[model samples]
Target chain A: MNVTEQRLPIIELGSLDELWFQVAGTRCNLTCSHCFISCSPHNDSFGFLSFAEVERRLLEAVEWGVKEFYFTGGEPFLNPELVAILERTLDFGPATVLTNGTVLKPEWLDRLRAAEQGSLYSLEFRVSIDGPTPELNDPIRGPRTFERALHGVELLVQFGFLPIITMARVWDESQDAEILGRFRAVLHLHGYDRPRLKVLPRLLLGAEAKRTCGYSASDRVTAEMLVGYDTTQLVCQHSRVITDRGIAVCPILIDSPDAILGHTLHDATRGFAVTHGACATCYQYGAICTNPSSRSPDAHVRTIDRT
Target chain B: MRLAFFGGIYNNHLALATAIADARSRGVDAMWCLGDLGAFGPHPDRTCELIRENNISVVQGNYDHSIGHGLNDCHCGYTDPRDNHFAQLSYDYTLAHTSDDHRAWMRSLPAQQRLEINGLRLLLCHGSPRRTNEFLWESTTNTQFLARLCDDFECDVILGTHTGLHWTRSSDTGSGVFFRPPSPIHQVKLNDGGLKKTPDPFAFINVGVLGRPENDGTTNVWYTLLRTGNDVRGGRSPLPWEVEFVPLAYDHEQLAREMQDERLPDEFIETILTGWWTTCLEVLPSKERTRGRW
Candidate 1:
């Protein structure tokens, strides 16, 4: 009962709605400056999850009535068994994977499309790009990373997959319309006539913390902030990430030691204390890592319509 | 016995009128509307009038609840800024035009309804039984989840229409257990000699909304007609109720003109005329979104 711990609000896992797997761990091809995990080929503090490991959790998730499964990391495809993992997941429920869109293979997409068609679920590919164009995106993700990612998008579209282009908001909020419009127009030029875009708020942590200003001391979710707040807005309320080491509270805070809740999914179901500055960002922007298909907290806003 | 289910009229009086006639022509014993009486289309009161005149049993949708209680937003639960802006515009138009009496009637409507037909228990709801505005997409929703909903609600069939798409999924895997007692625990005792392959008894149906055309490249809206049969399933032995998705073709030009006259966003008018969703596109799952013309 430290006073500091007493002040931090505890968020309970309402339900095991979304189960995440840090499949590739902190291993990525392009070390994006804004990457919260600072994932790079050289940085291997975290490791990839084996196909068997993911399968075990998929089976465990069924009993808990887990709604959906998500794969993320430095890059899930970096794991040799990523395709096999997704194919297995579709057997249980819908699966979504977060990748940099730079390293997708055609054979992988072909196999995934057949698997999705064969199963009663969907296999969603979420491709990440910082900005719409190379001039704007290269500065954050790396040189020529935009073209490579866009090429991946073209491949996905060729395989009849509607990839959701996930871009971290590195520019002003007002630039959203212009950026999205340009991205959509660009995608159309590359045969992705109908492009899906998700603009994510930048998280000031890990590599991003070094790239820009980290969260200030005042940027913490306090007990006072929980007053009449919809706790579901916080990912910890309905989700848990299964890292190579253990299950963490959320995908964003995997680097934090305190983020590790337990060794198993059941143990991870317990409440988590929102003490990190990243929690403040999660507080401001709900549904940070969830797929658009999954229900975001705001998806349930039922205020009567006086309009 | 046969019954017709209409989802989300969305103030499209033309579609509602045509769908009602179509349902009646099919000799449906009863017609039910799965709420969402207003928003999007023009003249909210006209759709309300059609509902009252047609004697369609209605359940409360998120839009109905919000409008009935005079809430600030339609509670459609859109996340994108562009989607919200268009949603707010539609809600404002619907609210300002709707009469207080209709709003009161909407407030009085039940959130969900249960009916028994030919020994089959059917639960009718706006979205899902768990929440009013939940989007239970076809590709994302699995058989296990639907079976769980059926078990929780204690119904053989659950019908909803919040996603504005028409699709049905039954536990047709032919291997998984279909019947489980309504309990929080997942552990359940299998019925009918335990290990015998039980027929897929539970069904989750999303009767496509009459509000607007589905994002499919067709200018026709859809509804659902469910018919009762012996064994809920007869010759098929496992297939319980027969579900039919009835597509209704309305005068798109007229609807578009009405929407335009109402000063609704041109985006909405574009949807009516083109059958492609131009706004509120963010809520659609990738599977549903990919099929659309954007």
Candidate 2:
């Protein structure tokens, strides 16, 4: 892995129609090989966002015509004020939170359930399970993470919610149906039938970069390649993630100081050229914002030349 | 023409039930909530069943959606250094205090709802209609508020719940208004004008929470009595029974404790809960119970 110091670009947070709240910001219990942020419990490069901070951004977004809110983290649960912060945020619009599912307890689901009960807003949860079962997933996520994550999934099903289980694509394209089928059966056994599963591509950065390999020169995204491409499909086009340091361009690139905008939302809402290598993947694949209310990933994306 | 909206009560059932009881006592024509019968509260399924039993209209709050989809985050915004809000002491205490089927039953909540009260079209949403976890408050701009209300949906009023504080506002279109009742922020205030750097002194409710002239600093569990007609004289007014108000108790200590545990700025928490805890969170635990733990 290349350890050379690179001046992170100060990417502007684009005409932000939305804001992503990094509740636990760059803090996670497990340091995955392919984690874009290389988040781990010990890595305090970014800390948890205070409940007040989140509320503040949410209020600001409300002015920008933001229609929704989303949360992500090393493990959002790592932040102590997560639920309270979410409750505070839900009033602005619908909210979706991403988590590893390993730490999710039944009671936590209930509190969320309760909060949704009394409001006029909505909430959704996306659980991260990189592989179908432990064998395929534990290798990437760490020891026993799959088991605990699956258990957490069971609680969600038992509670009657069919959570969207997100997994980074680890196998070849030919394995999609097989993996999904196997996952369906597994969820059925655990009591979920119409389960929503999301498969993501790996971004070569963070712990994953060091664990295996980083993106090669061939992997870089060039400006010419984006001509006529759907730029808004990328999270950077319309969304900015708020972390402890400040608002950044997207959830996938937190380490770059350039990703950090000043203290306020108004300052963050400037144009950001997708010059980073990751910009190539976004151009190739599509936006990964994953709002349940949004069109499916297949909706606006073009057929990728996986030749 | 007057309707009431609220957010998840969890095992804060006592607090919520009290709020509802107060609303009922005040003769509120209708009461609604976002959704989340249970995730952490002791009575998950029961809370779900209660709404079903009462037929309380609601949109699926994140907890309800997460539970329905088998995801996690409690889906509530509360953070648990140990596990998000659901697993925390104050939140868990409420969940542990509720029933099982109740929590389980909450999974069936709808993600969105549309209601029509009198001539008003309302979006009874748990989160923003566009997505969950999106919080819109009175603190938001009239433009943002109008956009969320008009462009997002066909509702004339987004009786938005959550945030727990009560608020109401007229849009730029003058076509409708969006309202948020008392939230965990404790107090309730409408769109009068939060323009000043600080919050407004007069709030949505006389009891649940008030910004400035608060008792100890916490939300005062005040309720609103929107009469069948336009009667602002609900108790605070000169009119007799024609005037009604939402009456709620204030538990200042509990408010103080919950705020402290949540690490709310000491100045704000101390003030709201010191005087209002007795009314709102009792929802806020007592200082003795939440000290050190916070």
Candidate 3:
């Protein structure tokens, strides 16, 4: 089919299973070279979401049957009310925070530990540490970031939390086993004996697009690609990100103009056209944004007759 | 009517036997096994045999689907490398040990079962009704989502067991109960006020598994005893269903010893003996994980 005849695949919101907040917006303490949104200390294109905004969204999320809540940003902890935001969120459902892991305070963690204990929901801390060693991660994330993030992981462990250490894949795929082995050993040495590690595929957007190569003109999800496919594997099928500007289709595409769906959660429920190269990446690696526990296990097992 | 729901036997035949006996003693009218008949335990055939001998209705779980079709992995939905390593170990062992006869039987099991008990519509599946390997953790699953599942499946209750943790969410309070009719004609009719009230209060129950300890630092596994009759709430409450999570204490030490003899991972044996999950920890939500001693 010609470009004019080719139709972009449209995926409807399956269920508002995950509602994420760009709490810190496009602002971070450290500007990693491969940062997707190019978040840095100076970047304030998107500002912090106040406690009231999160509370309003939390209440609105209940109406949508939102299963879980996620907090992300240039750095979620950069938001002054982040701890309180999370504390209030636990009242609604399980809460997961994606952080650079350098700005954590014992006082904040103490309050969070108490909040989690009091509530039925779980408070998950996904600490971003690009690699196991400073030599590998420091150049990408910034100087001393690796040590700072490791100390943050140590603090989380000390606070009785099994933080999921998230790392962006900077090396080749073949090095995964070796890298993970070394990562585990490093974590064990720091008293995190049973550390949880999550390796993320690099999203070629923002700073990463400049670091690597951007998506080519041919990179797009076509309607034909979705036949008999488990669309639920895609993040947009079950999640939406609430940003200061408005609601975005997914967390990874907040910078894109078309990514913003609407100002309200209800208005954002309209079907999304998978037309971006980033969307193709989401298709290639399904559920890249969601926690492992939330992903459907039989997603790839198409051989079974699920009658 | 009283029914017993067992989740994920996972080759723990000892727990299955004890739970069956205990459920039978409770005067359950029917017994059902939500699948995963093999994993993390010894002698997959024994669990399948017990389910067959007892004549319990089975729902196909991801593990059952994998083993039946000779798939590569258990599809237990663990994303961590360590978790997958242990899962593969368990899946390989179970696949090798399960008899072809039992594997065929597993292949024949339904993905989900719909039943009507005393005017209440019930759906039983290994996981959520839509997907067999879906994890419906109590803390993560909201009432509105459960209501939507009930509406889509046209059931008053959904009994599933994929997450291994036992918990229930009820949509009786009329929150998040939007009507998305199955057909466009029904949607028009509903909009025209043919059906006025919101969908009836429905529930999603994860009938705790017999696979292993609930990662709650206890050797005892659990099953669900669902009762529907005049005796429910002493006939005072409008809701007819009553859910009772029955904790079943079995010879877990024996199961662990058997696993050791079977050369299963020490992690599996440790969970059985200590009642704290060593493997498969990555698949647990934070609340569930925090509750455990791991």
Best by DockQ: 3
lDDT of 2 at A286: 74
Residues B114-157 of candidate 3: C-alpha lDDT, one tens digit per residue: 89988999999888887888888876665656765776677888
Model 1, B61-175: lDDT tens per residue?
Answer: 9999999999889988787778889999999988999999999999999999999888889999999998888889987876667776776677889999989999998766421
Docking class of 1: acceptable
CAPRI band of model 3?
A: acceptable
Model with the higher DockQ, candidate 2 or 3: 3
Question: Scoring model 1 with DockQ, what do you get?
Answer: 0.38
Which of 1 and 3 is ahead in TM-score?
3
Instruction: Give me the displacement of residue A20 in model 1, in angstroms.
Output: 1.0
Q: TM-score for all predictions?
A: 0.90, 0.53, 0.91
lDDT by residue (A1-307, candidate 3, tens digit) is 6775457688988767899999999999999999889999999989999999999988776555677899999999999999999988888778899998899999999999999887767789999998889999999999999999999999999999999989999999899999998999999999997778888888889999999888787767778878877889889998999999999999999998988999998788878888888777777777789887788333462221112
Off by over 4 Å in 1: A1-8, A297-307, B116-121, B173-200, B229-233, B237-239
DockQ of each candidate, alpha-carbon based: 0.38, 0.05, 0.42
Candidate lDDT scores, in order, read 0.84, 0.57, 0.84
Q: What local lDDT score does residue B128 receive in model 2, on the 0 to 100 scale? A: 57
